[model samples]
Target: MSLATSPATAATETRETQRWAYPALLALMALAIGISASPAPLYGLYADEWHFAPITTTVVFSAYAVAALVSVLVVGSISDRFGRRRVLLTAVATLIAGLVVFMTAGGVAALLVARVLHGFAVGAIVVAGSAALLDLRPAEGAATGKRTGVAFNIGITIAVVGTAVDAQYGPSPLVAPYAALAVLTALGLVAVILMRETHRDGRAVALHIARPRVPASIAADFSFSALGVMASWSVLGVFLSLVPGIASRAAGTDNLVFGGGVVAVMAAFAGVSQLLAVRVPAKRAAITGDFGTAAALLITVAAVDAGGRWEIVAAAAILGFFFGLAFGSSLRHLGQVVPAAHRGEVMSAFYVLAYLAMAVPTVLAGWAATTWSADSVFTPFMVAVALACLLAGGLGLRVPRLTPDAVPAH
Candidate 1:
């Protein structure tokens, strides 16, 4: 029964297994990312259709983040017990339901509900899809780690770009983008059904819900990394929520494609930066990239205040590149610090921080826009984010590196 008795047969089986696992996991991640980004381009359209103000639109978006927060707190570890495939299926089903609600959205209430459901779907996907990837790692090779990194980058990039393009130019503002997502979710569900389950037997007996725990050994490491991630994501939240509004008012670019193109360009550059990070040390790349992000955000603030369209666009592109590098580095650092058993839980914590960062700043920015000019609002926001980035970078420099043996086995 052992592979040593028949090395060739074992090798063939290993390759075949990976052949299915990696692609399946990548598809799941991409679908999640796609759904997450789908709503960004349509916010302006929804504002007109729902007759809501900027604050209302931001609330609608924040509702998704709120739901994701709840999901992470309640069911984030469900896959650890129920199995990754089962939870993944449930997540996809929720996504389809969310899309349905989105396509049928009427008033702000309906939009809020749709976004909440979408957030739940994203939370579930982040936990389950990541666990599935870890479970599907190659049976006997170092290649699995590198491949997993690549898969993560590709999946998120595809999702961001796909959502941006569809929302911008697909068709009707409300119906077309969501309907397209529903189809993609369905396709992903089918793919999941065809793929083999990665985690089968070792289901935990505890059915009671509990809070996520970060082991002490990894806590300091996680904290340092999470701060950087939070700073970057906060910038992203503001960009996603208010940049379109700024573009319309300052540049008079009312087209959906133009607005979405700004985000798409940022995401594309981030994706490119992530692919490049494989050649560099994660820590070094993160520090360098974070500094770049702070610089870009400052440039963007200046451009926004000056009403320079091209400058804003260039700043966004550079910001996107740096953010991409920061994201890949953070995830890779987490992979290094956390053990496989606690991977899902740790990632859930990381994402909870990220989503909170994504939600809160936008809500505050929306409020600020009501009282102040976009430039005035962006000034303080940029100042706050820059300060946070500096703090993170300073802390990162002080934290000692953890050897593999130093990382906890559990």
Candidate 2:
């Protein structure tokens, strides 16, 4: 016998590793996303410690998100050249370094650096993890690898709540959570080590990062639906970036847990709504989400003015529910309109526009906060959100009702 190992034995070993690979990727993905969100609560802490203006806070918040956004654009296809396992291992190690920076950050500059590092790591982690999951899809199919972003939502929720608690009550509030997460991310590194490389011949594959663009045939439809998509998606972005400060101001308390809880409420309800959204008709969901989000945003503006914390929570639920309704349907609507040959380019454009659209009101709010009163930023920000949602609602009314098959898997 050659006796290197029995063929049957080797097969069993591969099967065993592959079996573990799925959950490993799932855990690592969740952890990576969770790390991206952990800083939401801590941003408030950073402001208090550094006495930075609201503009600085907004800049701090945007640093990571924008970095991740650009990184996704730049490296979204990098794994096609380098292989999934190699990219994944680099991402996790980078995540660890980012956490270490967060632990030791002493000023605004360090925080920004840490956030950008974390953002790049997350971008790489998401893209690479997504590809890795496809590589190891088991013979028995359950949900597809991404699972409709349930994992992403859950990760955001858990991280917000847990890091909030750590910041609120831990002896080493700033250090402890990041320290804990660093350990968890290190486990993710180990998971990547266990995973077999999917793209062994990746070196021969072409790598080209295309700029975002849609064919003219699809541009008008994309523009209209994108109104709904961008408006609805902006709610989540606004909450993640500015809501903690808004919540603290609305509640007249700086309780880290309370502010973070508002975000948790949005994430949890949004997650549940994802499961429920499919049951509703696509047109109805889009209509309700578009108009409902506008109304809720207007109400949220009032709640902030009236200093109503619980009202903010209610608005979170309403906004989240409606967001769940509109955003997914809008993507499906956009997807159906695009030609298969150009779907990738169109979707990339869709994402880029959505990200930039979200930044508009947020960046303005941050700048306005510095120039005017802290609460003054809320007026323009909420008004902007409401107006965008209203625009979407009007356009969405004209969209043709999609057949059941028109809705893409999220």
Model 2, range 1-410, lDDT digits (tens) per residue?
A: 25676644544455456788767777788888888878888777888888888778777767777777786776757887777788888888999999999999999998889889988889888877776665565443325422636677788889989988988999887899999898888887887887776654324666777578878766666776688877866666667767887789778988889888888877777667766765666556676778888888888787777888788888777777777667765665666567778866887788777766656555667788889956776767777878888888887667554334344433
Candidate-wise lDDT, in order = 0.72, 0.75
What clash count does candidate 2 reach?
Answer: 0
The model with the greatest lDDT is 2
lDDT of 1 by residue, 1-410 (tens): 46354534544454466577666666767667657766776777777766666777677778888888887766645776777678888888988998888888778888888888878887778666765665655352234445544554454445545655666667675787677768878988887777666664444646544445677777867877888899988887776676766765566777666666677667777777877886777777777777777887788777777777787678778888888777677666666778777765787678778889989988888788667755467779888998787777677777667744223334
Screening candidate 1 with a backbone cut-off below 3 angstroms (N, C-alpha, C), the clashing residue pairs are none
Q: Using alpha carbons, what is the TM-score of model 1?
A: 0.85
